[model samples]
Target: MSTVIAFIVIFGALVFFHELGHLIFAKRAGILCREFAIGFGPKIFSYKKDETVYTIRLLPIGGFVRMAGEDPEMVELKPGYRVGLLFDENDKVNKIILNHKDKYPDALIIEVEAADIEHRLFIKGYVDGDEEVLKNFSISPKAVMVENGVETQLAPYDRQFASKTVGQRTLAIFAGPMMNFLLAIVVFIIIALFQGMPSNAPILGQLTPDGAALEAGLKEGDVVYTIEGAEISSWADIVEIIQKNPGKDIEFLVDRGGNTLEIPVTPEVQEIEGRKIGLIGVYSPVEKSPLKAFVYGFKETYMWTKEIIAAVGKLITGQFTIDALAGPVGIYESTSIVAESGFWYLMRWAAVLSINLGIMNLLPIPALDGGRLMFFALEAVRGKPVDRNKEGLVHFIGFALLMLLMLVVTWNDIQRFFL
Candidate 1:
């Protein structure tokens, strides 16, 4: 379905850039990342590169960059940690296992009889546990083949998230959200350059038949100057005025066919979801310019970010409700609608959604980038890191609450949109 494709592309772009940001910064900070994943659930594809496994999963709702020491449950393997090596060939027996006997005295070396030098290699961590792995490596079998609550190997002390200074860890945590902003900026800039900046003058172009504009004696060639005494400079100005006043009468000063005339028009009030909004049938013309495009792109991104932050503030202060929020369902449905509006509109919506993702990740709740930064702030004040277990527990609780909230929001979206 077109909806499926649009949702995947939109969510994929935003999340990929976000995770990539963390991956780059983590590597730069000398932290070892085990996995760079683009989705959740069962992995559809995976491969090892350098020291990390890159994975693509079936779900598109989320993704993650798994850095060493970030998770408290993962423990670094000590030098004394032992493993069992099983191989089918005898020529490379000690060369692969007993050669390291000087380092690991208690390691088990099992020689299985098989034809040729094509040996099945396995380094079993906690052979007392079940997860026996068989691999076909030419030499080393030190891969983390563990099972039964095995203590896995984490990054070196210098490479762990906690081992690093507060500043380093803070940067890594904040990098994810910052990347989202960067993506929005890029998307906006490209769209502006390709499609051009929106017209500065408030000129009406498309007029819907039997709509509010037609009922008010307005024609397609009219250029609006002022609406309800507010100076209308562009299309944004028109929507801003209408949104603030639903079912309200407005005086429009327009230049129609070279004659200035005042036309009275009232916006039609409509109930969207749970909110009352106003709408008038009209469209604006887009103008192309290289210089103005860049400026407009930056300005638009800033404006969208500011508006999202304000909306979040309002939500926190009880000025807004959860009904006003769009969860996965609403987003998927909107993705379908936006996809139908052509490539430019789709890109524009992607930019807006990317900005929203960036803002949401900056919220100071547990299990989020902002939450980790909160811990960093406490460390700055205390001159040392907080108790690792306590911090982890707080994030666990926060994650649970967030999941519950998502369930509720998703249910609401389904009921509102699909049902």
Candidate 2:
């Protein structure tokens, strides 16, 4: 696959899954998610529903879920949206007035004259306000079109994020990372059981009839211990060496009944699909049970999460350095290589990346999910939220520093991978 295509899919899926988590939790907690955008910067395409603007932006590396009153700078705490219009089964003008009286309890109803409102439906709210959503807002079938200017009112306070309890707010913040973790587990489950994972032992499950293995004196059920003096842990290691050295002499170390034997064999040079490749003529067994796959998938995600936490701990203790980090460029290059390997390989790598993203977001660093959770935890103890300006200043500084670090790491990755 083209590196660009690989980069887009990998980045898009990971980021979309992460943002979806926050959006779902926010809606559940009665917080208005104003926008759910994939990527950053200028939006290329967008659609609005339930007061949320879903969009795909220009950048492909990251995404965001914009909630009302969550970011004090971007959104108004009492921003109002025209959700639904009042309509009546009654046909006359008095019916419309009665409909407004019965349905629009909080809205300021206004009548406007229009040039073309015969049999057509249109509901106009605030068309001049800077933040008013005016396009595609009406859902009524029989409501007459209001072409003239109309006044709108503020939305209910209960619908804004700032009005929610601290616990609910914390859940919405944490949900983004939690969704990433769930994505990893689901991806792993499908790949591990259905696509089948590489056998750790790489034991030969069966031999071909008079094929390369039979001619080379290799028997079935042979446990491949090493190849070319390198200890073998999985079938992937064996395939890597074989594919690279087609028709070349291979030294295999196998354990048969506690006896170590060195077997020399030459892989068959096979020409297919305009490429010269090596064929070992043996198949490895695979795990195919759904229940077992689920169990192992969870275990794999847990282990990966633990590894990430350990890496972070090491970095904190000066045992690890910034050089170990992989920026966007590094991820793109790695994804390209994995994509070339096969579908299963890419799936496994994506799962690992998802788990890594989830774990990273949970770190108690400023401007991250865990950082907000830290403040929330403090609020729970102190019985009051921190000062908004102070918290915003800290996050602003942290975001700046993070962007700087990203630039440095991206430069390093460009030097290592591209240049």
Whose TM-score is greatest here?
Answer: 1
Poorly placed runs, candidate 2 (over 4 Å) = 72-154, 198-215, 219-284
lDDT of 2 by residue, 1-419 (tens): 47677678877999999999999999999776778999898989998875678999998868889876655432111224333234344422211222324354543343332211222333344433433453323223223322222221122356667778998999999998999889998998898777765455577766778567778878776788988888888887777777777898888999877888889878888888888888778877565777878887888889899998999899889898888889998998898888888878888888899988888888887898988899899989999989989988888888898899999999999999878
Residue 67 displacement in candidate 1 (angstroms):
0.6
TM-score of model 2 vs. true structure: 0.67
lDDT of each: 0.75, 0.73
Model 1 residue 197 distance off true place after TM-score fit, in angstroms: 1.7
Quote each prediction's TM-score.
Answer: 0.70, 0.67
Best by lDDT: 1
- Clash counts for all predictions: 0, 0
lDDT of 1 by residue, 1-419 (tens): 77788888889988999999889988888887888999999999998888788999998888999887666543222333443443335522222332344454544543322211112432223333433653232323223333342323334456666677888888888889998888877787788778766675688766788679788998886888899888888888887887677788888899988899999988888798999977777766667677777777778889999999999999999999998888889898888888888898999899999889888888889998889899899999999888989999999999999999999999999999878
What's the TM for model 1? 0.70
Task: Compute the lDDT of residue 239 as modeled in candidate 2.
Answer: 76
